[model samples]
Target: MLGGAGVLLGVAAAPAQAAEVSYATECIPPAAAGLDPVQGTTKVEVTAPATAKVGDEVEVVWKFVQAASKNPDLIDLPANSVQPSGTLKAAGAQSGDIAMQGPRENPAIAKGGAMVLSDMKGKLKLTTPGEVTLTPDAYAINVMSTDTKCSPKETVKSAATINVTAGDGGSPPASPDPTEGTSPPPTSGEPSPSESESGSAGGGGGSDTGGSGGGGGQTDFTGKEVAIPYACKTPIGDKNATSPVQINAKKDGGSYDLTVQFKGSVMDSPADIPADSVKPSMEVVLGGADKGKVHVEGPTNSEAIKSGDPMEIPDLTGTYKPGADGKSTLSPGVLTVKALGTTTTCTPTKSAVSLTLDTAAQEGGAAGGSAGGAGVSGSGAGGSGGGLADTGADDGGMLKALGLVAGTAVLLGGAVFTFMPRRHASRKAP
Candidate 1:
């Protein structure tokens, strides 16, 4: 599934040199699972062109060996359900991080069986004519819906280096065809950048519900992975977080079916979070040929979380329909999470487009798609209904009760505290 998600940049002209590097890595399963961290060695072989012209886009591949640890869960995992995502930290001539993702090609593994990760590739565009060093950074292996974040326990050696030279003002030479070694593109309607950017623009500005825009082509991004950054208000303070969102869209009769999945994230809580106290909602913003927002809400957690333990938010799902025609870009907007009596709102700090699709205009006043259905609520433009599900409890009363309980516990000296902080050290998920 991941193999088809690769972007087709131009190929290089010459054969690239690959370097093999192995290092020790430590991984921690999702905090909600309450599993101990494990240490293992990771071996990766990196391939990149030894030399490239400035401003040329070069492909870099990181092939991995068998994982250090096996499947830790009890159930057997099916093939191609595990996806790997990581960062290639670049230094020297180049100064930014390159996001690398691999196809979900893992073989079926029984519980506690050895795990294998797929090779990851990223495209790096050479800007300055100098040498650049690339080293593997922290990565995450998402099995099913759970994630195990891994990082090198020590300083990692460089995986590969590239020397860049000034290029002539002419067109770049073509390298080997990507199809020679990579998997073929999927037959599904995964739109290319060119196709997604095409189409005439027409749509309304602000409405919580209803269709806006003119008719155009359709773009299906069922399993695509999108990373969005959020600034969230936590019980402790304001903290920044990133969520890996998976989007699915299909054209139904007169309306489009859209499903947004939040892969889950590790959060901190200053107080105990009761079961079913937290609900999350997402606002998907539309741009390009159409303009508006679609709101999707998720369910609450089933288990109680003690204070100081990592708070894991369950995945959210919702559907929306588009009425307008033409290409519209969907980007993550505001994320609101309601826990206990307190509400934590997270807003996108940057403009990150998740997917773009063309929709056909609905004729005969077909009631445009509404966000409310399929275990989640959806609202179109100007909808006042909050994206989050109502707990039906009084927020002020709940907060006041919690405060009294905390005060009584302090007076009775019956308070208990447990804290197990996350241990990636200086490494952060890229």
Candidate 2:
């Protein structure tokens, strides 16, 4: 698995810090109590308004508590991490740094066994009117073996929702009666007078589409850009092998072009197994305007697993806008593979990679110059922002042990039942 400290190194060096940083948090609801995969009762709760306006700045607070068994051992809280997921977005604080605290002590042990509690606050504002639902699905905590650090078992806890109302200027005013000496209104489908005026403003000096009828065209958020750090914890079939991460992003049209490449190989013991049987896969989870899972399969086709040849997944092309906090985060998702008719799940070593926006650079561009690279496509191999790629995780040996036991059972059964059948021959007591 990727370590949190290791992942931060991949991020670009920050410029001199400014006095104040405008921050915003993604909208999300809390999680209900449930069982953590490792060993404990996991409870998550997020408190926020049930409804908000389009431009209303809302505060979202969350708390996570994990109660595990009380062993005399002291565990690092960094290893037990949790992250917010779903439609919520974050802008200011470093997402990788946002997590539960407490160095090596179990705060909830006295109340129960071993308990960890984390409380954090974030802000958000909805851009569009809709039913926004945010859930806490990222839970990376694993049960370690006496001799080895096994892969983390990830699971989702609970979720919450918010209904964002339309903006103040969303609807048009009612038409006055022609009988009152006023001119007749335009057709029902046509843009109103106010909308027509705003459309002209958007087209004259901005890139806003004329058809956008409300709020005098969207404010250009293109100049916002940041180098987000990332790490690869699990590489396909190998839990111990290194998994490198590379991200190349450019502003294109209204969105950002992101191409994430994971480089690693599958290296499990008993190498004589058929290469075609090894199918390893990993995914990247991105937040912002574009939020979802981008799944990448290991080495296209059913190619054999070779140490020299690393797995290069496909590119992710989409638009990305700043979230409420004005920042974005790229994180490691789940990793899975199938070998010898058994599937094994693995988690990344690190929790997340954070990207903070360069406000000075953004202001310079916003002054007059337009952000470059509209509709630009990802140039494979070498391109701008292509230089970022590096790596390194572990998994339980449960599947392998089970498979071995099954094979041994089959062999023993054949010797006892199939071969010894003649002892109780069909001729009865003979």
Candidate 3:
């Protein structure tokens, strides 16, 4: 009788499974129409210790660069025109952007005209034991001068990952008592209270797969929210300390369906941020994709995220390829919302964002035919620099070269004319 009931439940739930995929697809918006992103690209590089203990504070240095000569020009305004800021906060650590205005020193212009924004630094306090992906929020820069009539916007985003291990004997310090042995923390290896509850719910249905069963393969972010602070000048000269963003993942066959929602105050980022003036978007470069592809999708205001409603980032649904080690690393991309009303673009609070995926269960069962399982690789660094120095030939030098060429041509013509006349006269005399 119990087995028969289980079968009936499965049959009823089949429609829900199809709905999950449809929902995921509709959430993430397609690329903008007629607006091709700048031909230039940016990269992010990091410098930090390989491993650190929980509760320890560490400094993470970031170097942003414009990869090639085709790199787009950064928004150049007076120092106070637009505020450039970001944060180092991630899953385990707590930190903030070091320089509020911009990088302390002007970035260097390297050979091949690569723009390098180096020495931008920040600190993070490790609170949990696990690998944390550090992706600063989308730092908007002015791509045009202050005089432009209508200034379209561009963004700067990069990522890095840091591993935080347990302090004593590779275990998190749970209690202050010295006698108590080290155990992993809440976000660590051991199951959390929520995960345990989720697992119990799944066990009853006989659908509990390997690992913590949050919908069998889903990553549950039930009560938690990712906070990203932002500050800007021009349109609204204020800073938002807390902007709550949520990410929910559900297993969809071999892939995962993700739903990202924005909650809390509608005026968090900008109190009166005009919905039409603001272009909200997100770009993700995950390693688990087909061929190490960077997927850019957003402008969610149309479908998933509306101006007044709590916007949801949809279509983050895809199968993650596991690496050779049976695990896939994830680097978080920037969530950008640009305001075209003014020339300035603000920055997000958390820049370095990342997550991990355990694909061993799926690989062992269905994807075992592949040789090397796919995994998420770390993202590269971007660079920025001041405008190229004036190095071309001056007007005086150009005139001088022109004059010399003209004089040489005249002299040669005169010599030919003189010699030809002499030869003709000699022939007549003979």
Candidate 4:
């Protein structure tokens, strides 16, 4: 009697098993809650081109949920946890995009970190044309800048594991997939995603037997909100001080206001360096990305550093919004600097300036550590002439160079023409 009941249940549940995949999704920002995510989940489903047959358009799905903490610690935050989930389609359709949806950054001063979203789906594609079989392997999901160390097209690596192999019963492996940890071997790993979607211009109807193939293997969707772990990650009180430190600069330490240039390089002499140490050099950058529109000033909007003394830039704790007219007043002891980034109201208790002095034997470097006991080695000394005298080339440096070249060329050409013999043919002898 029990056997009969079990058979009846199995038959009834067959249709349900064939339904599309679904699951819960939990989004996270590592420390936003002052604890690891205690309850969350993420669901993933795959889509393929209509033309693909059931066998052709393979898909995969993943579902996850965060567990509540039963621990007694003020709050529970788990790290390095794993919740395994999989789908048949995910394994079959290997030559396509794989993606994940969410992550968010929290700006709470009490709990702030980098906001980031891991879109694992974008990385799927065919390395070669045709049906490329995908297999599970270790992978990473990462954010990338326009740098040489990353793949431009795929930003997310959805599957850190894959398994692709022929299964018995006229179908691929069923639940508890045996192909775990292995993927169909790729022909070559040289930047495979670039050419996967367009199909082979060089070959036809090739078998994705061991690689990527078919169409619409990947999908793109909004990335889940996530905070970058390192965004504004510097410690609250850390200071970034520069070299050839000045007190109050005149005209932002320049010839005029709205144009302070800090020469970021220092002259170095090996003779000045101790035999036990390496000569130090300046490689610091000062000024804004749009260096033309920025200037230095003390509290009260008094243009330039008139004091010729070191200024202690306080932490900015208020909102600072620059007016359309590009003018703002600095609170006393707070340095007001306008640049291209977001308007920061807090004064920089932590300031950074590039030192041009030789670091020959200077202890604690501006880079390796603090500026403590560091020497700005030069006879030119502080206020030798002016603090910011060699800070940097003015924003007008490029324009000046161009003007000089053009003027010199014009003068030289005129002189050459005047000195050359003029042919005054004798009244056109013809």
Candidate 5:
């Protein structure tokens, strides 16, 4: 969870005021588990700037006062297997819920033992100027593949309030104007000189194949020079890095198939990164007509990268179905990279829309909804089909070793049971 705090720190420029509050929370297990709800008292300390100007990005931190307890089932949990996410409701000046996510942080915990949960952090851009009250809202705790959602049992009175002031008129814009001279020149009977130059520049941009037109009338954005600013955590410490991204989308029946290509970057590492150990997942924020987020995942690096060598990131892909009609815009949100058993998370500092498209409303329920409330949605280390890799040994050898262990355990169990006495049947009374 501290990894997430490091990512948010990159966006903050000044010191912040903080307040601590405690409340009673009730948590319910997933429907499939068919378990009763549990109640617990939790304390949290919220940190945020007391004053901020409009359009200025500020960071909000939520530190858990103590580690969370294990579930009622008392199942043992592995290291880096638990993650926490929640919403912070804002009222008065700004009135929307902000989603926060923390990286997986915890040592191996035995049954009924305490589970270490990381602190949650998120960033919000001040849109209006006034006093905004931020109250703690609902949250979800994910252990392995199961999720337990929790909320305040009673009304939350204690909160953090910030006074937002108007920004200076001279502050630079957070994003590039989409209508600026970014469009390609029109094609005529013969290509104009400017058109030829534009095409040449697009071709030499990067690894993306510059073209549009895929099956089902798809739009491709290959070779587009769009650099997204990200606050990243590396092995050494927290660092900011920007990398170009390629996005393509096409309407598939009532849904859309989106493909995102992240041209990997080479970053200096203090320690060597093992092969097939790095996995990345991204959360794409939806705006305009639709208001939600979509989760996308990428494959792991195939080879090992030595210390100080450049690391490579693979492309990501996911499917999204529109819930409402009209035009929608897709923007990159948080980026999570896990390497060498340690999780590093990154978030975009500024707004950058990857694509905008129009679609009709769906008749049924939306397939992919936002995982959290606003901002980037919280996701596990391995979402969907993506999980950690088995390193060091071959698959066959690992299976054989597991079989040997199982066989020895069975023999030991028989030896112990041989001397144990069996229970006699109970007699019924007339």
Candidate 6:
């Protein structure tokens, strides 16, 4: 989570009495109520749109949300469009207003049930645009979401366009969540007990010891001695707009019941989950132009509890992109969930229970089991059909724009370009 200090850092670095700059996005809609969120799409627009200046960036974060009332009418109305096939196209006056150079895209996922929802979030890097000078400009900055029977609205919260004083290296903060200041309600299930970190810290401490992610912990006879950090990641090319978070639970001195817990984000709406390609996990499951394809799985424990011991769950693994320094950099664009673990539901008989992974036949021989590998292939040590690869997320050439071509003599002859909005912005709300 980006903290208030980060804003302070930006403001402190800003020149005293800096340029007058502000920002807005067409992320939300006017009438998103009474929707079940089957599918939806999201696009962006800017006001007085122009090429954004450097130091200022437009951030976007997209996720899935479920409506309180999952009416057949609402659910059938495109239960949340999330496919990462969106675009921030150029308009006559729109192109020049916001800067577009090195526009780092960040996409994240959060779990929103019928009572949960996802918000449209993206950050436009207010940088230098070609053939454009530094000055305040007006662009339409329109965000569009459409599909068959899908909600035709775009601006979720309105005030879509904003004015930012460019060239001063200043960017605007994200639209705040009205419920942010309020305390979040607790969940029903018993959470795994907190583990003492060799060097640990967390919560609203302004800082916490960054521990390893997913399922790696010690489980003794002590109830559930394992404490896994709820960490999340975004896809590559993301400019760090938002992140995916997960929580795992384990019982010590018990039969192998590895229950990995994960948390999804609450969005301003629920209709954008399927169309916009937003998910609760950092791992990408569907196929894409540049991201290729991913097989995902859920955390599981094959055996029932027997004695007191912490059971181990498959660790969530993917490619870790490093910064320019050659070391691993923790940002949105550099992260990707290569493979997801599959969850197998086996019946329980008396004192015995079995588990297996529900494998994908198309991907090849996979069995039913919970937990995943940390490998790009998602097979784990055993291999196939889930998230968590041995190595980090791979550059599978999955990033590319879609296009249509002519037939006949057009075989590698003339190339036609087709464009669509694909990635969700990862910039966090300031």
Which of the numbered candidates is closest to the native, going by highest lDDT? Answer: 1
lDDT, candidate 6, 140-182, per-residue tens: 1111121112232333332233343444544323542222222
How good is model 5 by TM-score?
Answer: 0.38
Candidates sorted on TM-score, descending:
1, 5, 3, 2, 4, 6
Span of ten consecutive residues with least summed lDDT in model 2: 193-202
Ranking by lDDT: 1, 5, 3, 2, 6, 4
The digit string of per-residue lDDT tens for model 4 on 303-395 reads 222111222222111111121121211211222222111111222222232211111121221222221112222212112123222223222
lDDT of each: 0.51, 0.29, 0.30, 0.20, 0.50, 0.22
lDDT of 5: 0.50
**1-430 in candidate 3: lDDT tens per residue?**
9999986653331110000000000010011111222222234455555566665556666554432122112211111121123333353343333321133233322212333332455565555666755544333331110110111123323255566666645544454332122221111111111111100011111121112223344544231233333332222122222233333344455554433333332211101122333343343333332223223233423322221233222223223433223443333234444432223322443332233345444453323333222322211111111221222222221111101111111111111111112113222111
Give the runs in model 6 whose Cα sits over 4 Å from its true position: 1-236, 241-248, 252-256, 262-264, 275-430
Off by over 4 Å in 2: 1-242, 250-252, 255-257, 263-276, 287-299, 302-325, 354-430
- Model 6 error, position 182 (Å): 36
RMSD of 3: 35.0
* Candidate 1: segments with Cα more than 4 A from true spot: 1-12, 169-430
Q: Pick the candidate with the highest TM-score.
A: 1
* Comparison by lDDT, 4 against 6, better one: 6
Q: For residues 1-430, write the lDDT of model 5, one tens digit per residue.
A: 9999986764454568888877877666444332345556667788888877676767788787743233222233445555678877777866767777776665655443545677888777777778877778777765433456778877886468788766656543455232222122211111111011101111122232223332345433222334455554432234444445445565667676666654323233222334565566778777666777777776665665443354434556676677677766666668776543445566766655656666556654242455422122122121112221222222221111101111111111111111111121121101
Q: Estimate each model's TM-score.
A: 0.39, 0.25, 0.25, 0.23, 0.38, 0.20
Candidate 3: C-alpha lDDT: 0.30
lDDT at 151, model 5: 83
TM-score, model 2 to reference: 0.25
Note the clash tally of each candidate: 17, 16, 33, 65, 0, 153
Candidate 6: C-alpha lDDT: 0.22
